[model samples]
Target: MEIDFLLVGQGLAGTALSFRLMEKNLKCILIDTPLANNSSRIAAGLYNPVTGKKMVRTWMADYLFPEIEPFYEKLEEFLGKNFLIKKNIYRPFLSVEEQNEWMGHSSDPLLQPYFEKIHTQALYNEVNNPYGGIMLKNSGYLDINTLLDAYASYLIEKEMLMQEEYQEDFLEVTDLGIRYKEIKAKGIIYCNGLGAMNSKYFSNLPFAPVKGEILDIHQDFCPNVIINRGVFRISLPNGLQRVGSTYSWHDLDTGPTERGKRELLEKLEKLIFIENKKIIHHKSGIRPATKDRRPFLGKHPGLESVYIFNGFGAKGVSLVPYFSKIMVEFLLNGIEIQKEVNISRWNQT
Candidate 1:
């Protein structure tokens, strides 16, 4: 089979990129063995404007937020499902210093519009905070599972997606093009998430796949907003709240550990106002993070036709739309990748 593009993995990165390419009349095949343990599938897909311990706005939150909002909304229409949900972010101040730091950063004229002057007196959750925290006007969740399944189903219905995994041995490289199994393509794009660590074209990109666990509680006590206590709490669309996610780089195991459960429970119990909330599900997956924690995008320097669009880490909801478009433009045209995200920065031809 011949196609214009061959994509490995069906996570958000691959799905978004493939969707963009197919928009330009390109035919692509997505190869993957759906891992229930895959990070994108298990992620809470939370998008928060105010992030980090300092409680400052996320990097480029102003630009990225606006760009991502309409992108997910459009995907909802294309996929015939809702992918993005908007909500407020309630951030608890852990200390006086932290509160002061928020005061200092809040003065920035650039950040002023996003700053909340009135301290919220509302205690939606116990949150371990006696003093009320500030509320970010814009924050919310993306339905990663729904979007992934919908895209996978879309491809399957068209017979363009395969459930089988790819083995390198079957690949035959020639000056003509790259070949894997019976498929020949003008080029191959590696969007395999953490699996990209072993990719021949991009293995040296310094990926740090961090493992995180999220607990899904079936309780309705979860407010309509995402609550962040520096380390936890998120709101889901279906009235399910995700209190998580515990980050661990050393223990890269995908299995949901007893430690993760215990830790999450301990932290979550602090915010549960309702007495009888029940545990619904526990999911663990490793995010394909980079050393700088920025997304990795663009084509390989050595191989003109080869490319990558991975290393989204925990910000897939915020990062994918912006970079995915840049990547598609780079794939279709000779668009110069931003230096920060270009693949060539880590290596040379």
Candidate 2:
């Protein structure tokens, strides 16, 4: 069947892109291999205005943050599901000097939009924030798995999704477009996460895959808001807290390791005062990060109809919504992509 686009990988990138494409009245089909360890499914789905140890504003915070709530809320209404959770993020100061430093940052005009109240005392006695902390506004986590599952079911019911492994050998590129088995489309976009590494059309780009592990523990004393310090502790429903994310560039397998668990526990120990808790679940997934820490976007250099929309790394929850709109616009109207994220940036390397 002829369609406007054939999108591979129903992960966050593919999911968001498909929705954006169909919203524009473009006919699209999504193919996904359910066996693939989808990083989007396992992600904690936190979108913070401030990131990193230094706690600087995230890249494109102004543009990216504004689009998040509306985009997700609109999608929620369309799918008839509630998955967006808007909550505060409490980042405790590591020292008095850091607290003083943030007090000065509070007045900065650039940070005014996301800046909330800065506390001189601990917001919660249950948590280990003796040095006070900064409460950021417009920050929260998305229930990515819930959204993906709901969206997948919607796609299935609409007959727009195909659950099958996409093999390159079966693809035939014609003058009109591309054909993968019975599917014919005017163009194809690959949002298959790290699976892009196997594509002959765009494999030369740098893809630094990192393994990340998360744990769901039943900690009673965990704070209501997300606590960020050495590690991030996100309060979940049902008296469980999700603590995570150890970045390991060497061991790129999608398996939980004892070392990973130990690392998370040790880092978590410094942040919260939890002594004992039952480990509810352990999950691990590989993120498709890049060398320069930017997403891979735009069309393949050799093939006009082939495009890429992967490499969102740990920031997929925030990045995908904004970039997916750009991708759809670029595909449908030939609009130029952002220069930095464009795949052409890697042409010289």
Candidate 3:
């Protein structure tokens, strides 16, 4: 079968790009391996404009934050599913000086858009925020598993997704396009996360894989807004709160460790003062991070039809939507990708 694009992997990166491609009336197919431990499936799916210990604005927050709600809302409407949760993120101040510092930041024009409100006194009685905190707008967590499952069902109904392992040996790269066992496409983009490390096309790129573990705990406290500081605590549908996550670069395996669990618990204690919390579930996945902490986009240097849209890493939830549109533009119109994310930035030597 001949198609415009053959996308390998049905994770967030592939899913977003495929949807964007289809929106432009392009014929595409997604080949995904049925892995139970996929990173997208286990990600916390939080998108915060302000992050880190210093509580600074994330990279490209101006460009990325605006596209997030509209993109997910449109997709939710198309799939007829409700997976986007629009909740403010409340981050407590570590000291009075920090609170005073944020009070000054509230007036900055550049940071004004994301600023919701700043609390001077304790907001909740169940938590440990004695100094007060800052509430941020346009911040929330996406129910990724729900969205992926619904999107997968839609793809299956549309006959656009193929559930199997993609074999590179059968792939043929020609001057015109690419050819797999029975499929012929004008181009094939690899969105297969760390699986790209095994491909000859992208193996040279530095992929720093990091393992993260999250826990679903049955806690009595259910805050309306997401509490993010040392660790993020997101309230789920049931009487459970999803808390995580610990990052470990040395251990890249997708397995939850006792050390990881201990780390999360210690951080969780600092974030909140909750009692009678029980660990209901523990899960882990390895993110396809890069050395410079930017995504790999654009076509391969030597092969015209070969491209990669991987390496968004832990920020995939926030990065994919905006970059997908950019990728589609580059793929259809031969528009140039931003140098920061372009794969061409890395020297093959």
Candidate 4:
């Protein structure tokens, strides 16, 4: 079959790309192999406005959030699914320094737009609250795994996906175009998450893969909203909650580790009481973190028809809706790609 585009890997990047392509009435086939060790499959699908220890709002929040809101809603409508929801987050202040930290920044105009002034509260006085926190608005979570499964099913039903290993050798590229198996395609895009760590075509870019561990705890009582502290908790509709997510840049193993569990528990102990809880699941997955920590997008310098859309890192939840839409426009129309995220930065280096 002849097609307009051929995509490799069906994780968030590929899935998002295919969705947009189909929206443009493009004929595209996705070749997916059961993901190797680490991809976006295990992502918590979290989007935090203030990140890191300093609590700075992410870049381009003014532009990104509004674009992402309706995109996921549309996905929910199309798939008959409901993974994305708005639940307020409770950010507990760790110490007096932390409270002073928030107060010191109340005058900053850039941060003011993202949230309101800190209000005093004692939700966990018995637990730990040297100070309190300001509630963040316009933030939420995405059920990444749910979206992936639903999209996979949609592709299978439409015969738009293949379950097999995608070897680059199968892609016969020439001055004219590209070919794979029996089909000819105008362009081929690789949205494989960490798999690009070793892709011969785009591996020249500074790609950093980080391994992270997530813990599922079944407890007697838990808050419906996501709670932020030393360790954050996102509530699942399934009644279980996801926590921890310690990032390890050195070891990229997928096996559950006792160290991550103990570390997360040590942090959790400072606040909530963990008396009678069942440790249901513990697994590790790697994210395609980039060197500068920005997403890597756009086309390859050498290969004209091959493209990439990866390096979402931990912010896949928010980045997906914004960047994916932009990518679709760049492909369907003659729109100029964002320079900061373009893979061409590494060009001529």
lDDT scores in order: 0.79, 0.89, 0.91, 0.79
Provide the lowest-lDDT 10-residue window in model 4: 121-130
Which of the numbered candidates is closest to the native, going by highest lDDT?
A: 3
Q: TM-score, each model?
A: 0.91, 0.97, 0.98, 0.93
lDDT of 2 at 280: 90
| Off by more than 4 A, model 1 | 95-109, 112-117, 120-125, 235-239, 272-275
Clashes of each: 0, 0, 0, 0
Worst 10 residues of 1 by lDDT: 117-126
Clashing residue pairs in candidate 1, if any?
none
Using lDDT as the measure, what is the rank order of every candidate, best first?
A: 3, 2, 4, 1
Clashing pairs in 3: none
lDDT of candidate 4 over 1-349, digit per residue (tens): 8999999889888887788888889999998875542457677777777776667788788777776768888889999998788866667776777778888888888777666448565664433554777667677788877888898899999998888988877789877668999878988888888777677788788888888888889876566667777788876788997886788898777676888888877777766665566778987888888988899888778777878899988888788788988888887775878888988777723
**Best first by TM-score, ranked:** 3, 2, 4, 1
Q: Give the TM-score of candidate 4.
A: 0.93
Instruction: Give lDDT tens digits, candidate 1, residues 237-307.
Output: 56776788889989987589999889987776665556566688988888899998888888777676677
